[model samples]
Target chain A: SQKIEQNSEALNIQEGKTATLTCNYTNYSPAYLQWYRQDPGRGPVFLLLIRENEKEKRKERLKVTFDTTLKQSLFHITASQPADSATYLCALENGSARQLTFGSGTQLTVLP
Target chain B: NAGVTQTPKFRVLKTGQSMTLLCAQDMNHEYMYWYRQDPGMGLRLIHYSVGEGTTAKGEVPDGYNVSRLKKQNFLLGLESAAPSQTSVYFCASSPNGQGPEKLFFGSGTQLSVL
Candidate 1:
């Protein structure tokens, strides 16, 4: 069976510090990987996407790296703030259907 | 513009009850999907539609059925609700099915089966 794993434990960091989240998978090869940010009581919002051929992608203060050889992806938030705290999800194409399978998610809390 | 919308933000039902969830999208997307989110289990796909009148089962589709009678609407039905069916249901839509596309999601419906 295919599996996607994220850090189950919550991460706490001081505001202005960098926050990094990891997503690892097994038994699957995906062409593209994506990250989403989910807030309390709301649906997830798209963050950034990185292709297998691309080592890293960036948008504003966010960056994502995809390493297909390791079947892992890393999401980073630079100069994080309190408002940046939320559950981050990593997703990849499941099969030929063009659907996505998401990881469990990692919760980051930024303290002022 | 309303990208996607789901009706009945919240609902409570007794076991064996039947209900349908309505999802509407104004993005004119070619693909739409239904998913359920639980505490420890991120989000699992329930059912999806590639186009109008075409529906397919996803990762978790045992207790659910779906209909895509219109291009902009998708309906998810539960024949007989169970306690395990209690979850937050989300509706999403994407522009096309060619490759990886970002999904636009609705606010979600919280259903509780007792």
Candidate 2:
């Protein structure tokens, strides 16, 4: 079965340190991979999107790298702050259904 | 601007009861979707619409019904609520159905089935 998997356990890191989260998929060739941040009791907000052809995409303090050959995507947050603590989700789109399938997500805690 | 709005921020229903969750968007998006979030399951798509008057089944469509009667509105109906139906429901819309469109989501509706 096609599946998207993220680390289910929460990640903890000190403020100002860099935090990395991984997303891995099996049996699916996605055209696009997207990241979203969801806070407590709120809807997810789009963070970044990286195409299969692109190795990496960056937006300010956030960076995403997609490795199609490895079937994985890594999300990085530099200069992480306590405010950056939230659940991060990765979604995969095959470009055929106009829909995205999401991973279970990684909860990051940036402690001050 | 209210990008996406879901009415009744919270709800509780008994088994076999019926209700409708309303979603509205102001961006005039061409695509709208309903998703339910549960612990350890991520967000599962229930139903989606490409445009007004059109709807399609998604990854998890059983026990749920959807309608896009207006361009800005999408409604999800539960004919007979079940305990398994309890989840945080979110409504999202995208500018178009084309490639790599980002979703703008509503605050979400917390539904509890008893």
Candidate 3:
């Protein structure tokens, strides 16, 4: 069976520190991967996407790295703040389907 | 502009009751989707439509039915609601059903089955 897993534990980090989250999958090779941020009681918002051919993608203070060989993607937030705290989800676009399979997500709490 | 809107932000129904959740998008997207979010489960795709009048089952579609009659509106129906069917439902749309098109989502409807 195919599975996408993320750290279910909530991450607590001090403001101004970098926060790194991990996403791992098994039995699936995806062509594209995406990250989304969801706040409590609200729908998710798109953050960034990285292709299998790309080593890394960066936008503003966020960066994402995709390693097909390892079947993993890492999301990083630099100069993190309390406002940046939210549950981050990683999704994989496998095969030809436009729909993505999402991981359970990891919640990040940045304390001031 | 309201990107996507879901009616009945919150609802509570008894088991065996039937209800329909309405979703409207003003983006004129070609693809629309229905998803349910549960605790410990990120988001499970229920049903999705590639274009108007085309609906397909998704990862978890056993207790749900969906329709996309008009280009801008999509409806999700539960004929006999079950307690396990209680979840936060979200509607999303994309310009096209290909590539890395980002999905625009509605606020979501919180449904509870008693």
Candidate 4:
């Protein structure tokens, strides 16, 4: 079985700083990886997706990197603000189904 | 356009009770999924449907059943609710099942089985 692991614990950082979260997987060749931001009491919203052949993907203030060689994917938020405080999740589609296998998630708290 | 919508934003049920969560999408997505989020455990897939009338078990499908009788709707049922079934449930949809298939999610259903 493929297992996805995130930091599990919450991450705290000062405002305007960069927040980076990690996701690692075991024994699965994922076709692609995805990142989502989930606020309390709400569902996750997709942020970025990086293919197996891609190294990095970037949005306005979010960046995601997939290193298949290391079986790790990284999510970064630059110049983070307090509003960015939420749980960030990493997921994968291992040539499996429309459903994705998600990591435990890392809660981010950007304190001002 | 309501990309995806879930009914009963919050509910409280006791053991042995049964309930169903409804999910509807307007994007005409070919795939739909149900997942539960728990503290420190991340999101666990309960069940999913590839298309209308086609359902499959996910990583954790125990204690739950699903039906996709219509192309735009998916229903998740808990035949006999248990304390272990308390969690926030999410529904997501995608156009197809590939390319990290960007997902559109509903608000969610917060269920507590006491």
Candidate 5:
């Protein structure tokens, strides 16, 4: 079975420190990967997407790295702020399928 | 732009009742999906539609039925609501099936089945 795994633990960091989140998968070779941010009681908002052929993609302060060879992706937020604190989700498109599977997500809290 | 919009931000239904949740997108997207999020669980794909009048089952499609009668609308129906079905339902749309098309999501609908 295809499995997607994100850091299940909540990450706490200072406001100015960079926050890193990891997403690992097994048994699935996805064509594309995406990250989303969600706040309490709200739907997730699209952040960045990196294809299997692409190494990295960035949008503003957010960055995503895809390593198909390693079966992993890393999401980064540089110079993080309190407003950047939210649950981050990593999703991968199933091989030759339209469905995107998501990991459980990691909650990041930035303290000022 | 309204982007993606779902009806009834909050709903409470008794077990065995039936309800339909409606989603509409104005982005002229070709693909629309329905998902359910529960505590400690990532968003689970319930059903999706590639285009109008085309619906397909997803990973967790057993208890849900969906219809895409229009280009911009996707409807999810719960025939016999159960407490296990209570979850935050989200609707998302993508422009095309091309690589890495970002999804536009609605605020979500919270359903509580008692």
Candidate 6:
């Protein structure tokens, strides 16, 4: 079975600082990877997707980098704000059905 | 736009009881999935449907069953609820079962079994 590991259980950062979260996977070759944001008591919201061929992708103040060789993905939130405090999850596309295998996620808290 | 809606935002059940979670999508998506979220285990898939009348088991399908009789609706049934079954259940849909299509998730349903 494929396994996904997220860097840490929780992360605390000062507002306006850059917050980086890591996701590593094993025993699977995914065509694409996705990132999602989940607030407390809510389902996850799709944030970004990057293909295996793509090294990096960015949207607004958020950026995601995929290193297939390393089987790891890095999520970066620039100029983090208190509003950005939430859990971030990383998932890998498993098959054509697009069934995703998700990581445990990293909870981020941006202090003001 | 009511991308995806899950019925029974919250529920409490005693062991051996039964219940169903309904998921409806207005986006006319071709793929729908059910997942459970616990404290540490990420979102573990329970079951998924690729299209109408078609269903498949996912990573964590035990104690759960699913049906997709209609293209826009997916139902998850718990034959016999147990305390271990308590978790937040989420429903998601994608436009298609291919490419880089992102999933649109519904507001999760919190299930508590005692």
Report per-prediction Cα RMSD to one decimal: 0.7, 0.6, 0.7, 1.2, 1.1, 0.9
| Clashes (N, CA, C under 3 Å) per candidate | 0, 0, 0, 0, 0, 0
lDDT of 5 by residue, B26-46 (tens): 989999999999988899999
Each prediction's TM-score versus the true structure: 0.99, 0.99, 0.98, 0.96, 0.97, 0.98
Q: lDDT per residue, candidate 6, B89-113, as tens digits?
A: 9999998876788889999999999
* DockQ for the candidates, in order: 0.86, 0.87, 0.78, 0.76, 0.78, 0.84
A1-112: candidate 5 lDDT, tens digit per residue = 7899999899999999999999999998888898999999889998888889899998888889999889999999999999998999998988654678889899999999
How big is the positional error of residue A89 in model 6, measured in Å on the Cα after superposition?
A: 0.2
> lDDT tens string, model 3, B1-114?
899999999999999999999999999899999999999998999999999999999999998899999999999999999999999999999998778878888989999999
Per-residue lDDT tens digits for candidate 6, residues A1-112, read 7789997669999999999999999998999999999999889999999999999999999999999999999999999999999999999988746789899999999999
**Per-residue lDDT for A58 in model 6?**
98
Q: Write the per-residue lDDT of candidate 3 for residues A51-72, one digit (tens) a residue.
A: 9999999999999999999999
Can you rank all candidates by DockQ, best first? 2, 1, 6, 5, 3, 4
Candidate that beats the other on lDDT, 2 or 5, i.e. the better one: 2
lDDT of each prediction vs. the true structure? 0.94, 0.96, 0.93, 0.91, 0.92, 0.94
Q: Which prediction has the highest lDDT against the true structure? A: 2
Clashing pairs in 5: none
Model 4 C-alpha lDDT per residue in residues B36-71, reported as the tens digit of each score: 988888888889899999999998999999999999
Question: Which has the higher DockQ value, candidate number 2 or candidate number 6?
Answer: 2
Cα lDDT for residue A110, candidate 2: 100
Native-referenced Cα lDDT, model 4: 0.91
lDDT of 4 at A22: 98
Docking band of candidate 3: medium
The candidate 2 chain A region of ten consecutive residues with least summed lDDT is A93-102
Model 1: DockQ vs. true structure: 0.86
Tens digits of per-residue lDDT for model 2, A1-112? 8999998799999999999999999998999899999999999999999999999999999999999999999999999999999999999995566899999899999999
Q: Give stretches of model 4 more than 4 Å off.
A: none
Could you give candidate 6's fraction of true interface contacts?
0.82
- TM-score comparison, 2 vs 5, better candidate: 2
Point out the higher-scoring one by lDDT: 2 or 6: 2
